[model samples]
Target: MASLLSDIRTKYNLLSKTQKTIADYILDNPDATILLSITELANYCSTSETTVMRFLKKLDYDSYQIFRVNLAKELIDSPSETINEEIAEGDSTSDIKRKVIKHTNTAVSDLEYSINQKDIDQCAEMILNARRVTFFGIGASSAVAIDALHKFGKIGLNVNGFQDSHLMNIHCSHMTSEDVLFVVSHTGESVEVLNAASLAKENGAKIISLTSFSNSSLAKKSDVFLSSSTNDKKYHSEAMASRIVQLVIVDILYLSVFMQNEAKFYKALNQSRIAVSLNKT
Candidate 1:
């Protein structure tokens, strides 16, 4: 039995029209269902009280009150509970500072606990030996991909980062057995990114996946998987910590490549400097 209202929606087509109306209302106003009585819900959904009762029965609940109670309990235990309902007015500066510090510290600690040296080493080895490297990410992660390109280029490696889905597919189509494709996804479920990784795999390119979820689609498809901690406060803040972790991984690879081929790294650095000097007034 699915307890989530989302799951209930999946089975909604099986319900009667009146029951479906109540289900839609409950889904849209989950908090209201917990706080409002059956009469109130019936009036709000423009349905009769009997229709609400039948809706609960279809969901396998014995009564409307029981359904509301369970829904309230679920809401209380949900991840959104950690999110503030509204910003408090006239908040002290110190109070705001403390809350920020606490969440940041938690994010750092989570990242520390999640790191694995063995995985880092393996990722480094694959990257060092690959004939070509391609990076795929979207949104904020696209920024991370750009940073990776800069770092890898500095160390005398051929790296490309793509944000556009169509261009990414085009790049993946050119991948061969000697190429390595690194995919960065915080949620691990970005459809376009996963599809690119799939295409890269089909082309025989080695895949390295960086994501927060160990069981994510990209992770499941990769030849090597690296996970960063994003289990902090449940919002974009969690992704901030994830980017920090991804940057750390990029730095590790940069250092490892430099150490392995110091002369080549120095040559690349000098060439970059001279190129900049040529453009100077």
Candidate 2:
């Protein structure tokens, strides 16, 4: 079953003004409003009871009561129950350090709640069976793609990460069902990444998307949608937190792939180490 939170995010763009306000409140305080009455929710959202009903209908819920039940269920099932707060302006160095570390750890811990083990195992199987794996990302995600390329290559996987827009298109254009395309984007709305993903899908390549939201375009197009937690303060992009989660996901995928063919992977790992060690001396 699709979680109400994910469904809300997917349909957020189509909501009315009053509906958006209610959505914003629910998203910000999911754990709190799960038990609120329709009257209370409407008052809290600064809208009428009718608006609440309309909003529920918009999301395809049978009734407001059903919506509340689903929302509560989603909150309970969510990966991380960590309540996010904005970083204060005045803080000691130690305070800042503690805050950043805690937030990063929360992001990683939340991944356990968001991703299913079966999905991870399935994706790993796809990677092992794929003739080639091509990674495509734009902006900060490009760095993640490159990192994944390096990690997987050490395990002797046929992989490459593409940063250049034209090159990404060119490479994806030639891919077929035998290939796997990994697209990484925090917002999942990168135009270049979407274009390449579309071309790859058209050419019959399976897409594995790593993003922060499951309702994003990239997620919609993916054969497997992987999401990470994202909570950034005002004026601060999710560049750091989201990137950390992306890297962790990459590491998990790499490890899963490594475990699948342990003997062969051990040989490849040793050979790569020797090749690099020779350069150091």
In candidate 2, what are the lDDT values of residues 1-281, reduced to their tens digit? 54566555445545777998887678668877877999999999999999988888877876888788877776777745434444578877787777777667765665665667887887899899999999888888989999998998988889987789999999999999999999999889999999999999999999999987677899999999877645543435656777987899889989998988899999999999999898895
Candidate 1: worst-modelled 10 consecutive residues by lDDT: 79-88
Backbone clashes under 3 angstroms, per model: 0, 0
Q: How does candidate 1 fare on TM-score?
A: 0.64
Local distance difference test, each candidate: 0.73, 0.81
lDDT of 2: 0.81
Candidate 1: residue 46 Cα off by (Å)? 32
- Give me candidate 2's TM-score against the actual structure: 0.76
List residue ranges in candidate 1 displaced over 4 A.
1-98, 234-238, 277-281
